[model samples]
Target chain A: MTATTSEPGLRPVQKSRYKRRSKGRGNFEMWSWVFMRGSGVLLLFLVFGHLFVNLMLGQGIHAIDFAFVAGKWSNPFWQVWDMLMLWLAELHGFNGVRTIINDYTEKDSTRWVLKTLLVVSALVVLVLGTLVIFTFDPCVDPGSTLSQCK
Target chain B: MTATVEENTEAKPGAVPTFEVTLRIERYNPEVDDAPHFEDYRVTVHGTDRVLDALHQIKWDQDGSLSFRRSCAHGVCGSDAMRINGKNRLACKTLVKDVNPGKPITVEPIKGLPVEKDLIVDMEPFFQAYRDVMPFLVTTGNEPTRERLQSQEDRERFDDTTKCILCAACTTSCPVFWNDGQYFGPQAIVGAHRFIFDSRDDGAAQRLEILNDKEGVWRCRTTFNCTDACPRGIQVTKAIQEVKRALLTNKF
Candidate 1:
């Protein structure tokens, strides 16, 4: 060890050593970050709107029942709203949890297992929720007393 | 005089015990060596002695070639931040006895920064990020005749982030920063937060817009490594979270 002498790899930092390509399929991480903020903002509206309509609307909490849900889903407008909410909320939440797993899980296998479970579970919920929202039928039974059926 | 000095040197009841320890320091001389290697030094130190003291002893007594940085010899200047036993810490703040007493303490340059020589790393990139955040207060008003008065509540809002010392410990410890050097690391975000939350500052919007870039606060993965490595005990992860929330809420 000497006090000071020659230039090894120690050159002036002209440009950043960080080599991030501006364009590629590798832009997934960048898009993921963008999606978090975008979906987060969208979710605030969708979630609050869903809440306002479901819990605090004309009938309020007291009016909620199986038939009340059937009536809302009967409308095409509600179907799209619910579908958008389901997709955005699930993907947003899944990405958030995936980030968390990446941060905490040091073991490669543990991260792989946890992320796999998360993606599978989120897909399951998204597929099921979408089916329920779009394919829902209030008149499944001909003798049903629901107002939606009548 | 020698007899009196010997008598005074005797340990008192509450005096901490001294122990012989080894310091395994990573040595890299770009002039002389192609690759880095470790040099071990045996030094007898009191339990209260900091790791910096051991380095000083080695430089003074053992090998004059040994190179490291120290200024205040206290934690305030943040000059001697390095990896001690696989963690970033201020050498002056870490007591030898506290970090694995009997084992050899390993000292190396902080990770994610290019080593110029020995323990000193090039801090230009780190400071560049700091500069990008605009760490100064940016109020638009004319110079006040009197001091700009802040209410107690408002002052306290950004107090935690105000303790930053420009030490790259938190920034270098972050895996995100380690992996992607382009990302404005935690230290920069903490600096931005200092101004972003200050009630008297008018630059919050501009700073927030700057941070909204792809490699800004969103790059933080909340590893808690920054929080853990902070010598000032600043809640770095919490500050990052607050900034993230601000990005969406558009408020403090």
Candidate 2:
């Protein structure tokens, strides 16, 4: 009997033969790797700063009431901070997931559907989040013209 | 090795040995034209010679311009996924002889992703969906001074999700993803599945919140294509179902 080995089918990669696509914008993978490191570094600061402000400052975690949120939104500084956080977190998190999808799902139709849902959802959140942060009103004098919160 | 198997058809049992089948393949060239065209080759094939092997032979002997990506040809690397006839398959594991005995096969690149050159599809958008799932394990507890111990049951629960090979078979198979590129797709579910069952994670409730929005897990139509296409034999629909069940029960 001839001695044989487990078929290379089990070794999907040793044959590697990974030649990057010849045509694309430029350095897609390189920029992606860079983006991960950059985003990771930025996320560290954003996440920590957010935690410190919300959980450790002033009355600390107890200051998270709706009024606390309205108070912060009144200040442009907090608004921008929240905006940046929202955008970065959403983009960073979403982009990371897009990578995983391409790697796993094989069917073109499935991939298409999944990605469509992702974009629609992300867009909806981004738009609504941005609007809420920018157009908030805190004064509630009852019959005042400040809309519902008034 | 597979070619040799075809060579031995005459040595078998009283059953008449079957002849080989040809596989017609689509070819593309960026420098020459705006479209891709078909090319055919007749090769005597056996049950062992997968379509991938046949393509390899054509490249090695007939055309050097033919290009494709394959690593760990056994299907672990998640590369070499393409269309065989109408279904998606890993070129390595799919045995050509089993697919058809009397007719030639057809091979094409996966849809949804931008075709970069020939069989290779651009993966930037797909990768983007992975990031959105928050695939990493996040903990709010104090940093462990020692290895965190987990009950064997907890570990066992998440074992299946951790096995994802990221082959793109499941995601590309969904109809929802075909029209919209932003859907998180199947791998994200697999990634969420990995941590969702872990007792070490406090992020399950929060993760579900992230997945609950309009574009979240609700987009799945329960199509079993993703489950069917998984090279690792993962139950994609099962994982999705578990997540859906959690959302309904936990009310988080």
Candidate 3:
């Protein structure tokens, strides 16, 4: 049959032998792209706020001793801030690495393995971080010099 | 080099060894056939002959019915791009000696495109995608009396994407594009990148917004097929990555 289009000015559609493959179920990739930007913006503030408080405030980098950290963690506000920073940065970093892995890895098993390690590592950091932030008691150490601990 | 040429010419005399190169070209006549089929034609070619030259010999000497597109006979013009041995390449650029000289070379229209008769594909969809991205420069305000000045760094930023000749090789090679026709292939993305990163162009935000759709830049899985298929050796994947980064940070 001669290549012919029923509609004028339109090219004839040659049926491809290949089957149509969907990227994924629902709008995962779309949300993934949006998350990168949204999380990235939030991360900028969280990260910078963390650095400014730790490095540039008061005695600057020299003031960041064990007592300084203990003093900050004594307040619930700092606990929440640290919590947000940990979660957002970890998830953002995870997503970024996932994208890189997807782009560079050639084999399916390699991608799966790398991604599994990524998610596992992120979860480990998240769980340990959340635990330390919420459950830490500086008073437990008898030799602690922190006024807030006393 | 001159002595070598003279000695070779003297040794060969009037006879230059020529061998038969069979072209199993895909043939489809929309006027009559419902499906496509391969038709083989044997053409004599020398070592330096390109696939386009072989096609010319076939069309001129063997059968006038053979149909293909060609211009400039070099890599320019972006015409006569076809699949030679399952890979998209410019027919004018592909030397026969490099692509299976002893066996029949399979010449077919590029994939993910509608075949229009013998080796030509319907390029309407490809061009439509290119047009959809608004490939031209979009600037606001009155036209400046002088040319829009751009820094060397700014020019270098998007220098790679500017080499696109509108060849459908990159687009047709993409598996995502083949699976889904609606997705703007790397060709269109590269075109948008050409303008999106242009320092003088005020339309980067607009173009980025246009490309932020569901079927837009996000659809690219970074298979690197487009980069591999590009005839100009343009960094197609790098351009796409730059576009993606722009979308994320709102900066090109």
TM-score of chain B of each: 0.93, 0.88, 0.92
Span of 10 residues, lowest total lDDT, candidate 3 chain B = B1-10
Task: Give the chain A TM-score for each candidate.
Answer: 0.81, 0.75, 0.81
Residue ranges of candidate 1 with Cα displaced over 4 Å: A1-15, A18-150, B1-16
Higher-scoring candidate on lDDT, 1 or 3:
1
Q: Considering chain A alone, what is the TM-score of candidate 2? A: 0.75
**RMSD, model 3, all Cα superposed?**
10.7
Off by over 4 Å in 3: A1-30, A34-150, B1-16
Q: Evaluated with TM-score, which candidate comes out highest?
A: 1
lDDT of 2 at B145: 98
Per-residue lDDT, model 2, residue A118, is 85
| lDDT per residue as tens, model 2, B90-148 | 99989876666456677767655666666777766666667666787789958999988
Instruction: Show the colliding residue pairs in model 1.
Output: none
lDDT of 3 by residue, B1-252 (tens): 011122244456676545677899877788887677778998878767889999999999988988988877788899989888888899999988788867788887887677777778778878877887788888999999998998999999899999998878898888766643667789999999999989888898877877776667887877788888999999898898888888778632
lDDT ranking of the models: 1, 3, 2
Candidate 2 Cα misplacement greater than 4 A, ranges: A1-150, B1-19
Q: Candidate 2 vs candidate 3: which has greater TM-score?
A: 3
> Between prediction 1 and prediction 3, which has the larger TM-score?
1
